[model samples]
Target: MASFATRHIARGTTIRASDCGSLADRGSSLKVEALLGATDQQLRTSGIDYTITAPSFFMQNFISFFTDDYKSGTIYQPVGEEKIGWVDVRDIAAVNAEVLLNPGRYKGRELTITGGESLSYTEAIAIMNERLGATTQFVSITDEAAVEAVSAAQFPEFIIDVMISLNHSIRQGHAEKTTNTVQEVTGRPPITFRQFVDDHRTTWL
Candidate 1:
C-alpha cells in the first residue's frame, strides 16, 4: 500500500488525534482554515493510509518578511509578546520524508512539527542581533496598522484578512507550544531559532 504525507500551516495550534475535531470548527470563520479542515476530513475517510504534518510558523519569515526592516535596524509586527514555535522548513521536510519512506509506521497520524523552543518576536530578534552582531530592534505595531501596511502592499483582501486572523490567534498565545515530533520522527532535534539565524547570517548582512 502506498502512503501519502501532506503539510499544512497549522497557524498556532498543534494537531493531535484529539484536535482534529476542532479544525472544522475553526474553519467556520477562516477560509484557509476551512479548506485545510476539509482536506483533512477527506484524507481521513479516503481509506488510504495518510499522514498530515501540521507545522507552526516558519523561521524563514525573518528572511522573507523582516529582512528589509532588519536592514533598517527595526522590525515591526503585530504580535506583541506572543511566543511562537517556529519550525524550519527543512525539518518539516525531514519529517515528511521519514513518513513517506515508512508509510505503514505513521499511518493515520497527524504530527505537529515545531521548533525546539518557543520565542516571542522580541526575544527572537535579540537572538538575531547577538548572533549576527547587528543591533536591530523589534517594534510592536497595532493590528490596524498591520492591516494597513499589508493593504498598502496590495495584498488580496482575503489574504490580508486571513493573515490578520492568524496574527490574532498568535496574539492569543495559540502558537507558543513546542513539539518533539521532529526528533521523534527523524531521530534528530529540530533546528533552534538561534542556529537558524546563525546559518542565515549573510542574508541579514
Candidate 2:
C-alpha cells in the first residue's frame, strides 16, 4: 500500500515518505518495519529526489493508546524497563515541513528523529504524575496480555500485532537511541517528555 502510493507520487515531484526509526539499523524483522524498509529501498533506487523522515515512538501515544489506562492509574505494556526516545508528532511534522520546503537540500537523505531524551515507561509516568498531579503507574505485561488488552479495546488484529512487535523492539533497546536530527533540521530541540506532559496536562486531568 505505502510502496504503491510512493511509486506514483515519485513520478514527477519530489517525495517524502514517513517511516520508523528502526530502519536506521536495517535489523528489524517486524512485518510493518520490513515493509517500510522495502519502500525506502525503492525510493533510494528510483533515482528520484526523496526525503524520509523516520521518527521514533510517538509521544502522543499517551493520549491515544494509554489514556484509558492512565485514567485507571496504570500504563500496561509489554516493554519492561526499556527506555524509548519518544518523539512528538509535532516535531516530526516540523521536520517534514522543513524537508518539503528545501527538497533539494535533503534530497536522498533519510533523517531519523527522536526526542532529546530516552525514558522508560516508569520514568515517563513519573513525569506525568508529577506534572499532572495524578498517580499513574507503569505495569509490565506479557506480550500476550498486551495483545489481549488491545484486542478487548477493539483494535484491529494487524495493529495489535504491530504494537506487540514494537514493544518487543523497545524491550531490546532498539528505540532507546536519541539523535539531534530534530534540532539539526528544524533549528530547535525536540520536545522533551516533561514538556509534552506539561503541555497536555489537561488530557490527564
Candidate 3:
C-alpha cells in the first residue's frame, strides 16, 4: 500500500464497486468519482492506477457539486494556466495491458499519466476555434470579487467559493507542470492538448 500525488495528475482507472454503498465510495454521485489521491489503506484492498488529478469545475460538476457559472455557457473555460492530466480511457487500458504482460515493472509502484501538455482551458478553446471554426463566446472573469458578485445572486450556496477557488489555482500555475510519464513508460512522446481537442472538438458545443 503506497501512495503518490502531484498537484492534479491524471488518474485513468474506473470503479470496481458497482453495487456497494460504503465509505469506499464516498463521493457526490451514484457512480464512483475518481479520487486522484487514494490513501495507502484504501490502496491495500484494491488494484489501482494512481495519479493526482487537479481539482476543477469539471470534476465538481461530474460529482454533482458545481455551480452553473463553471458550465460550458457561462464561463466556458478555465481562467488561467490550468493543465489537466487526463488519462484517455484507451491509453490507460493500454498501459494496464503492458503491466499485465510484464507484472514485475508495475506490480507495486505508482506512475504518472498525462494528457500531454499543460494548456489553459481558454487556450484549448482557442485551439478549437482555430481548427473547428467555433464561435461560442468566452467571457473572462478576472477576480474572486467579480466571481462572487456575479455568483451571489444566482449560484447555489455550495459552489460560490469552490468554483471561484479553481481560478486561483489556475492563475497561480498550480496546474502548469507536465510530467513525462507517458513517454517514460511507453517510449514515445505524449500527444498534445490540440490533438485531443481536435479529435473531440465536435463535442465542444
Clashes of each: 0, 0, 3
Answer with 2 or 3, whichever has the higher lDDT. 2
Expressed as tens digits, the lDDT of each residue in 5-121 for candidate 2 is 332211111111223333533335665555566677776778666877778889999998888889898888888999888899899888888887788788767677789998999
Top-TM-score candidate index: 2
Predicted candidate 3 versus true structure: per-residue lDDT over 1-205, tens digit per residue: 8996532222333221123211222342322232322433365345554332221223222113222332344344346445544334445445555655655566454544445665555665566567756543455556755675757669875455545544544454444545565566667666565665565544544
Name the top lDDT candidate.
Answer: 1
Q: What's the TM-score of each model vs. the native? A: 0.85, 0.86, 0.51
In candidate 1, what are the lDDT values of residues 1-205, reduced to their tens digit? 9996754222223322223322222344545555566777776777666777788889999998889999999898898998888899889888888877787788767788889998999999999989888899888899999999999999999899878777766776667778888999988999999889888999999
Sequence-dependent TM-score of model 1: 0.85
Computed on alpha carbons, the lDDT of every model, listed in order, comes to 0.77, 0.76, 0.45
Query: Superposing all C-alpha atoms, what RMSD in Å does each candidate have to the true structure?
Result: 4.7, 5.6, 10.9
TM-score of 2: 0.86
Residue pairs clashing, model 1: none
